[model samples]
Target: MQCSSYWFCPDVWTAVILLILCRFRGCVSHLKINKYYTIKSEMAKDFPTRAENYAQWYNDLVIKADMAENSAVRGCMVIKPYGYAIWEKMQAALDKMFKDTGHVNAYFPIFIPKSFFSKEASHVEGFAKECAVVTHYRLKNDPDGKGVVVDENAKLEEELIVRPTSETIIWDTYRNWIQSYRDLPLLINQWANVVRWEMRTRLFLRTAEFLWQEGHTAHATAEEAIAETEQMLNVYADFAENFMAVPVLKGVKSPNERFAGAVETYCIEALMQDGKALQAGTSHFLGQNFAKAFDVQFLSKENKLEYVWATSWGVSTRLMGALIMAHSDDHGLVLPPKLAPTQVVIIPIYKTNEQLAAITEKVDIIVKNLKAKGITVKYDDRDTYKPGWKFNEYEFKGVPVRLAIGPRDLENGTVEVSRRDTLEKSSFQIADIETKIEHLLQSIQDNLFQKAVDFRENMTTKADTWEEFVDLLDNKGGFILAHWDGTPETEQEIKEKTKATIRLIPLDARPEEGRCILTGKPSSRRVVFARAY
Candidate 1:
């Protein structure tokens, strides 16, 4: 019974009969194998190469993957269903974290009275250029009858400015509530949209209208407010590192970059693929500036009246931009498993409706088990798209895991699993596939974070001399650690010469004795400088 080959076997009839039986049983698997190879060949040509043009590749992937698109309004974008779903995942995770940390959510008005802007001189100066004014309350028919025009009679006694930030309005309301120190720490967070009339904009990075959560807190002492500010900054850094899988540098902003009217600003800065820095989130210590402006005085334990100390912190849709640039590749977005909208997508591969139905039955069981474990699974059983097309679509959309179940797989008690991060395929026994996938998702999250951390370390460099700084900025382009003269004038001169600004004075930077890289003046510690978004 030693058969050498099917074509040249001494027991040719026996071999032929065995082959025929195998073909009849495994025909679906053979067909799918062929289809998978064909799909891989076509996927190579679908996206722009990152080395060729990173910006174009990013723009193409955002739209092709159904993430977002420019809206009809001049500097805004409409987040599509897929993009919004990912954002919702982010919101859910962060919301839970906020609640666990003793914070409460509240709503605030979108419009601030025009007079409120003038109350805080420094805050107004910082945001004056970007404020959008609403002059009238209603519109009336034009005399020419072509279109409606602003009605002069409908003008309000005072105009309103669409809120660029909630500090002024929140502090005004807080004045009435803070008569006594029992209301010492007012921990309120509002998830709302704000408007700023930007001259230039990008989708999530800078838009006229954007969604965000702003936390405004009122405290009785300056120390308490500062503690709250630092606490929120740490929370943002943790979320960015653990959930978004993006490593960040925690630091305090320079005076030039501090939030208007705030005494100090704490921020988390992240590096992008193109050697640029992005401010992922910010927390500001207002130090009673807004409280004094709005007359928010609290009676202290010593029976003395004092202005309340304050802090305001926020992270917006801009985080969406940071997430996209930090881990994505030329192939498309590579989302962290913790933040992927659909953690698993099951695609059935079959030639006919009957085959698909059989495969779907097996997939349904897996989906149910995964859902029970809190994993989001999407069973793509659409007849309009082929299995190959569906695979590519989910890959572009950054689904963390993809499972393929066909008739052959059903018979073999196995399933094909593909990871979006590495684009590698493997087969797992169906006996405990759900548990295996849960472990795989965790591994994917850790792997993405490690990869980003490695990239950041590679990109970060230290420069001791002006020549080295110039070369790094011109060619290497990432975060450059260098000593500064500790003057805003020196910082500006460096920016004018090299277009690289001091991103931050890193909170952990050790004091070192060295001359300034630009001015040769005695320096205390190095600051992070980079071309940033």
Candidate 2:
């Protein structure tokens, strides 16, 4: 049966219904092409077209945009090639920076012995339940011969734990790899997969398995290790601001929020366009914790042996989720130029042989010049789709820039430049195309960061009392700066009452005299709190 609005307007119902279904389901399906009009007409009623429901908005953006999809295995994801391409661009940018900073990449074992984890008591306790244990090996034949069963006799005495992180085993190897003070700072980074068995997974945000780069370094002294920790945190902050174009608030996590076994944890927190907080990246200063656990010692220049200080920092595929929620809008993903796989794409709209020939000629020259300047470019000349289809496709893909050339422009000697970030279009002559593209790409990157910064500024609230804190979280839904009693009890109480946790204690936080909002105990300084991803 047709709906009232659609039945009253049958001719446009196809588009309306397709849009409605896509918005409600949060993704357009291949089977819905005939229902586009009707879906679109009712899309607004389903999605609300706002970031007020941030969790749903994020999930919708990731799945609806075709960036990624959930896999058959619970909490796991199949990173489609399109999503992987984005990761590749991110890897290329970050990997180059690591190399430039004198870091070398290495691979680590995916499975660590269960005993290795027991070496660090605190770390083991923190990750025990979340770790995936490999307890069995080969299975025996079933009695009915329908399936194989676990071989009771083949059970092993020891088990292996799929690494949630590589700190323990990496330190164990570092103990042997570093025997002298000369091998002081072993700056090693590993790009590989890690497993964390999360209860609930949301595409890229939380998954059973994900790819990431974990940097583990062992230093001769605590000072050097601390420096490495802070340095990498800064590196993460810089990358978030410049490459991903996501503005982050740099701070040190409170003890309650700190990574287990680490003396100090530094993190960069980013505000989503939806007013939620995502802990983008973290750097931990493990002051003798892992060194003592692994007995990693090095001979000092003074001819004595001393335990090394270690630091571990990592940023995961979750960065992709951060990018989407930080800059993307209802239209689709809006990638920063540096992180976009294709910074600029040329779409030629031509119907006649002369027009096709002219567009092909101009687009080829533009692609060549852009390539010479080290910009990634794509020319879409597929015959199956119209120019309007290609526009929506690239916009959905979030290419940083788009240049459109049609038959009309061929006679005028001009091309249309459409920027992805602002959706702004301007006409330009062929001669200045290269220079103009360079400026537009850089401008898009800058515009994205500034826009996020502005959103963060407007969303952050200062709460002086308990009621105000609850009210701010209930309504405003961003970071709350409030004084704490500096006790776990107070933190837990706030979390129990409100779903907010202490996101971070600013690295630049100052010592002040105040009272805890919950406990009324004398306190100094404040911690930022928000419901997190």
Candidate 3:
């Protein structure tokens, strides 16, 4: 008998009969079937929108884009190759800036003696809770053979503190390296990993261990050291604005918010899409603090001995989190053209080998031209995945410009271009396509930066009274420009009440007579306050 319905075919009827017989014989006591089932592609799963769940959306994007993931070690992360490539780009740009400023790269030991921390009392107190200490030198097999255990007999005479910041150790080394007026200006930078032992950790934002570059400079006078500090701050701001395409506010940190042993802390703060601020970078003026702590002194031009002035500045992988939150949408990452690892991706669509060969032949010329123009281009001609899959993959990975050429396009001597920033697609003649792609990339970068700038401008607002400050923080959730009494007690009180802290005191803030928003005390100028990451 022929089946009339597609769902109830002859095979279906046969299976039904077999099931009935098996059930009657108690052979299939519990039988179940799905009327219909559809397998969803992993790449097709949508992320939670920012409005729905901003935190989840960010976590999903980071993992889905193959950027990073939590590692076996708690509070630590494994930065995948794709994420590291972006970081490498940032390092390259900033490294050149450092070199231009007469800074040379150097290496410092990872393990610092516990005594080193004791040299700087405030520094030790600041990092004591977060430090990871090693008391034993070796581990031995367990007596029960379950696992290994720290060998008590192998304990060291002095415990070692894993380097949190290299101020103490770097200053100690500087003492030996500098002794006279000729070795006055010692500019050095080190690229290394540090362990902070954070209690709460996010993938890249607050990891226990992360990668960073710290610059430690020693100068003959305090004026020169301050100049170096400000110069590095500008470098960070430039890198953030130009390469990362994230707008930032340059300013000084309040005493409570300043870096632990620094006399003054300068920072560039960037606002994220979720209306929270993230400190993008910081440059700290040490003001002979470390030099005095380590007894690092030099012979002056007047034949007198004096302690050297010092400065330390650094930006960590937390900038990765800033980059992700600043501009990425719910769809996926929208990388700036300058920092995108694979800036241009070319995908060929074809049904047969001959067609693919023809498309590839054309793509090879396009790739060659793009490479000659110094563009990082990828030609994805793999037959394992369909054209649609490849398209979604690159889009999610934030490839700035995507070019697709099918047989029809090949015949017409044109290619379809898609810009990731806007998800806009258009067809253009393949003639001089290299120049077109380059211009499109620049336009995307500019658009992303402007969009961020506009968002920040809209989110920033002024609050006059304590009520207004509390309302703005609880309801609007952005940077609030308000008068502070310039006292740590008031800062602490505001934080305790509203969970908002002063983000920065603007460098160019004009002198405007005002009253403190919280205490109604006299104030000089308004400070930027925000709930930050």
Give the Cα error of residue 526 in candidate 3, in Å.
0.7
RMSD for each model, in Å, please?
17.9, 11.0, 15.0
Ranking by lDDT: 3, 1, 2
Where model 3 places Cα greater than 4 Å from the true spot, the runs are 1-44
Q: Candidate 3 on 271-346: residue-level lDDT in tens?
A: 8777778898999999988999999999999999999999999999999999988877656888999999999999
lDDT of 1: 0.83
Which regions in candidate 2 have their CA more than 4 angstroms from the true location?
Answer: 1-48, 51-53
- lDDT (CA) per prediction: 0.83, 0.81, 0.86
Give the lDDT of residue 199 in candidate 2.
68
Error of 2 at 69 (Å): 1.1
- Top of the candidates by lDDT: 3
Better of 1 and 3 by lDDT: 3
- Please identify which of the two predictions, 1 or 2, would achieve the higher lDDT against the true structure: 1
TM-score winner among the candidates?
3
